[model samples]
Target: MATPGFPPNTLDDEGCPLWISGLADDDPNHSVHVVRGLEPAAALEALGADPRLIQPCELPERKPDGWRASLPAAALGIEPELGDMTLLAGRVGEWTFVYDDAGATFGDVHVLSAAGRIAATSHFSINADASLTYYADGDELAWINVDDLDLETDPAEMPPELRAAFEAAGSVELDYLEPGEPDFDICMRVVSALAGMPWTLDDLRRIPLLVAPSHC
Candidate 1:
């Protein structure tokens, strides 16, 4: 099998982001969306987050725990079932990365595309299901279940980059990895390709993100 451009457990110096490799190790459930041509604040607003409620904060030194604790309880939302619902938006070039720990706003096509074209990847740890979706101009361009590479939407409408990314990811040999581990790497590759470059650990740690409670 040919080696992937970004392999699991590889260091950022070698081109794989820490969060990307860490995600493969933990397989935590989360949703990440990358929007083209929008600032973090604008991205948050396009995702239906209230501009008034958004605040600037750096990414937690390690995990979401630190910065999450700093937000007011009201800003964290009221639903206990949601468990500290917050949306963290940061920028890497023209792409705005939105990280949602316990929200499903990525599924709302209108909200996601309102900012710009978006490339998103989501995982539900409970069901062990993973998805890759793209939206543009308030419409869904493609939706795929990464587990089986099944098209949830019409294949005729799939974007060229998304289709090519899926094909490249699907063809790679991931047998050395345990189930679900490959999905994390694949998701990162697809999103990174869309973003035009890998998001370094430094970029993720130091960027000032717009934080807001998730309405979803």
Candidate 2:
């Protein structure tokens, strides 16, 4: 995928900001809920952690995990540059999460820099241990890769006009196709690819509806 931009501004019914997602049926064991409005340190503290204590002096080196780019952060477009990126993290029950307001940049989501101006990049993560990262596209348990994967699509499956449209977009924006339409699945791969990861046929059925509506 082009690399996910930012997650939808998903919030709880109380409107307290957080993104709820998982592998199955809101399964807590394999799920993540990213809450906002708190600094990285405070966020960790609230999750039954002591930010000052859970450290190797750098977030990426915490304990046995290089968690600076944990799944939640990467899902939001964060990447770890050197070994000094500031962040906070901890484990609560079966979930181990990290937080940082350094924010991330992809599509429209962004946070401010130390100069108080809009930052060029925000913080996101990658679950390197599992070789998995949650996707911020819509909602679901989608994982993406850090490296590029070769993909090919046969435009012959598309109609003349649709084929032309697909070709015009370099045949990459496949999810731009209307749902329930021919080639829609092929297009979804394009959408997933842009997010800096890819999706599989099995992944499509399980994810929440696409944020982009189908336009024939």
Candidate 3:
């Protein structure tokens, strides 16, 4: 059942349609296309049900350097919190946007990709009122901290299990820091602690890491 405006068409294995208006293999202008299933009428009906289902419109073409240009901060409209910052990175076909809103005090990291996708995001808060946030993509990672987030602390105070995990993940150095130290470093430490934990993009919302009391 092809929708009224969009005709049904053959789609390839990658979901690309055989014929697409204003779309060419080497055309830098269009990188996304709308494809219908074997049933064109149904696809057309779906398109009419949701106008936002239109194909990707802003995707960039492949770049020779392999890495696409970073998305402009203005695109995300991410306003930095009092002591926080935002970072962006990507290649021609992919991009990542990271927002760090906790200054050095708490880690609040958010990551968004060019396909309007969110890959991974993690946060770390410690007892001394320090925090860190991290976001990672295929090859690049970024982080941020809350103000006065990093202070000195003692590794001897860490729970044995957490201490062991940190050591195993090569983050043992963070075990001994006192309260109020660099939140970014601690955030990395938290990430290391969670290494090999069978994490996925969907699990990010379910996990919380607290390095110290301030974060609680």
Candidate 4:
């Protein structure tokens, strides 16, 4: 019954991006994908979305459901089933932020990384699974299961930057046997490192994003 950093209210001054963690706290199933050098529209397509269905929209005032309900007439009749995947994306400089309501993973990191680099964070609280991943030059540089600190990729093979990101997160010192949920804080730190800047909840809310339903 414990979700560390739930109801995120404070901003971290030390430059750890905790704002992305708020999406996980708000929904049991969610995925936030960041890709460098891609526009919101292209990022959505890279994630397998149909470009014909893409539309400019504000970030959800609440959850995806609320956002869908608030869509304008142009978006009417474009609804997918409740279980179907829908996503919202925006840009921060050269980085594109895509938030998936379905908690889905991308079909191909190679395609996504082709734009530049990819840094993704996801939490599926239902199955107690969470991941923070990084990819560049079409190669997966790091993939960590935050809940257990499991290395899906070989740790020794990770690039120096990925190693540094782990260190910056203080994940190197994490003792999995500890009693409380530390995944939230640790995951965000790694994301911040890969992203190379801080993003806040206010930024997420205020950003102009694009929305689409993914057929993939």
Tell me, by lDDT, which candidate is best.
4
List candidate 4 segments past 4 Å from native.
Answer: 1-27, 63-82, 115-125, 150-158, 167-185
Ranking by TM-score: 1, 4, 3, 2
Candidates 2 and 4, the one with greater lDDT: 4
Q: What TM-score against the true fold does each predicted structure earn?
A: 0.68, 0.21, 0.22, 0.67
The runs of at least 3 residues in candidate 2 whose Cα sits more than 4 Å from the true structure, single-residue gaps closed, are 2-33, 51-56, 59-216
Cα lDDT tens digits for candidate 4, 1-216: 122222233334322354554444333455667777778898788788889988877543344453333221123334446666677777777667776656665435556677456555533444656666677867776676665564334345667866665555543223543543344455555555555535566666677768887643
The order of the candidates by lDDT, greatest first, is 4, 1, 2, 3
Per residue, candidate 1 scores C-alpha lDDT tens digits across 59-114 of: 43343442333222223433224454566777877777776655356575456566
The residue pairs in collision within model 4 are none
Q: Among all windows of ten consecutive residues in candidate 1, which has the lowest summed lDDT?
A: 66-75
- Worst lDDT run of 10 residues, candidate 2, spans 207-216
Who wins the TM-score comparison?
A: 1
The Cα local distance difference test for each model comes to: 0.55, 0.27, 0.25, 0.57
Stretches off by above 4 angstroms in model 3 are: 1-153, 168-183, 197-216
Whole-structure CA lDDT of model 1 = 0.55
Give the per-residue lDDT of model 2 (tens digit) for 18-90: 2222111121112122322324344344434444443322211112243333333333234434431223333
Clashing pairs in 1: none
